[model samples]
Target: MSSSSTSPGRDSKARAADAKPPMREALVAAAFQLFLERGYEQTTVDDIVALAGVGRRSFFRYFPSKEDVVFPDHERCLADMTAFLAAGTGDEEPVGRVCDAARLVLGLYAENPAFSVQRYRLTKKVPGLRAYELSVVWRYERALAEYLRARFASRRDGNLRADVIAAAVVAAHNNALRSWLRSDGQGDATAAMDHALGLVQSAFGTAPPPPADERPEDVVVVVSRRGAPLWRVVQEIESTLTRD
Candidate 1:
């Protein structure tokens, strides 16, 4: 092991140690680290890029602004939700389908519990981040409503129904997700989501009415004076029961 021979091996090890995380992940990690240490408002994009060992171009490529980094996965998650809803066959129950779609958001949070909990706490402290988060939530709700609108197009008040159901799904999902975050991600998030979404499903997921032929025949009851003639009563009943 001559000194020159050992030099190459040492250099290679140093390179490995110095290698940076993937650019996008690096940006997010650096941003959160700074956000926690120095308040989010105090930390700038330049500081994040400096820590990430990347340029401003790289940071902007991944995130439009500081707030976007706080919620890195939402764009990807929203795209996944859109694709999931678009792939539906239209045969599924709309309310139930929306509830399932809402679960995808829970899955995103559950994928990194510690990170989720950290972000949750951070958002609570920052009113701007909280407002940004609400806007992100509205986008998700809009996606669900759009999908439901197409599914329910023929029904009366279809648009209204779609919007209402979409709101319910979002409300149920957020309720469960925040509960899990508040608990420090301790319990079964999926089960809690299921229970919350189940309520939405139960409230709005009634099966479509049976086909006209499969529906049971309508029954009619005739009310007549006790002294009225039996024939008159029969005539009245027949008229009431007759199909147009």
Candidate 2:
């Protein structure tokens, strides 16, 4: 007998299992459900596992603990942003890759407003969760910094400038995201991100797209002390402009 025919019930059961909710989502739902029912402190991983209808191994498979269920998609977001930065950095004038990275991080928050809001609120209440969330934010920054350093490390900018650029981009992105989250997603995150990156690019004498067909000479160049960090370089230029 053919497999499906030999085990028709097994086929139906397999379809049902496939149709079952995603493990992470199910865990999130279970945790939040129990949190609503029994409070966050009262809800144990065992409770979540039982409530989620999976074994403790399955729960651990998706999240390290009950609290881990709160930011269910964080790992995936980090992976996605890292992948995007890797792909987009290959053709960079530096700022392009930086902006793409900034945009990628913001896009994660934009991907799910409700979850972002929920996670934000929860992070605010839980110190450990808040630290974990901050670490998560920094992970993206670290990845972007590595990419930026790789892109500019061989250029005249060298590692110091690349490090500063990466740090500036990450800082700019975090500030924009905090502003957006503070407004409860009412602000335009994309616009905030774009505007922030524009400032970063202007500081570096690089534009995101570099005005197609324009000669490289047309691009504004800010000459700095060759060894200065990009931030110090921008600061030096700004201070000079203000001095006169």
Candidate 3:
């Protein structure tokens, strides 16, 4: 008995298929490669799909548009940041907590330095990408502001304070993040971010004091002669209270 033989060409084709990258990753890699070869505007969804060896449907399945491919991980990172903020115990200092949330964003960039730097450079060159990036940043800022608003709900001008501090946190984080990206991801990004965030924490991180009613009552003690005159006793008590 004899068995049928597989052709060498077909065997090579099978191996190539096996070696292909995952669909989503392949799409992203293809999109960036095309973006670099032909400027962002010159590149189209058809080009990306063609390079990725995927159908247009597959490209849209992973990314809504060509711009989304450039910022592939942001949506996931944003979800993580929102979850992190929501998980807070309410015992954390609001400013410090929000600063920590900002770190999550830095962590995302740090995860893939080469890719992040490439994307950063691309964003700098593309006005549309820059606008899209700004919108994404705005979403992050809003998440932080919402968390802060809840934390500061009982404070005077709480909404204003939350919005301001949230903006500050985003500013500080982006400042550090962009610097790191500018450096080609060299040096300690965490240190840079911490220093920036430290400023925010120092400026607004103090845990708000408990409500006036919740504050501990002040205690006063007055010393006087055993047979002190009422007027003198009253004077001493008033002086003690005033001094305190």
Instruction: Provide the clash count, candidate 2.
Output: 0
The candidate with the higher TM-score, 2 or 3, is 3
Backbone Cα, N, C clashes tallied per candidate:
0, 0, 0
* Candidate 3 lDDT over residue span 68-182, tens digit each: 9999888778888998998878888889899999999999899999999999999999999999999999999999999999999999999999999999999999999999999
lDDT of each: 0.88, 0.73, 0.88
Per-residue lDDT for 1-244 in model 1, tens only?
1133445556643243234337778888999999999989899999999999999987886678899999988977898899899888888888888888998999999999999999999999999999999999999999999999999899999999999999989999999999999999999999999999989888889876788999988778778899999999998988888857
TM-score per candidate, chains pooled: 0.77, 0.71, 0.77
Model 3 off-target regions past 4 Å?
1-21, 207-244
Error of 3 at 67 (Å): 0.9
Task: Name the 10 consecutive residues with the lowest summed lDDT in model 3.
Answer: 12-21
Q: Listing every candidate in turn, what is its Cα RMSD in Å to the true structure after a full C-alpha superposition?
A: 10.7, 10.5, 11.5
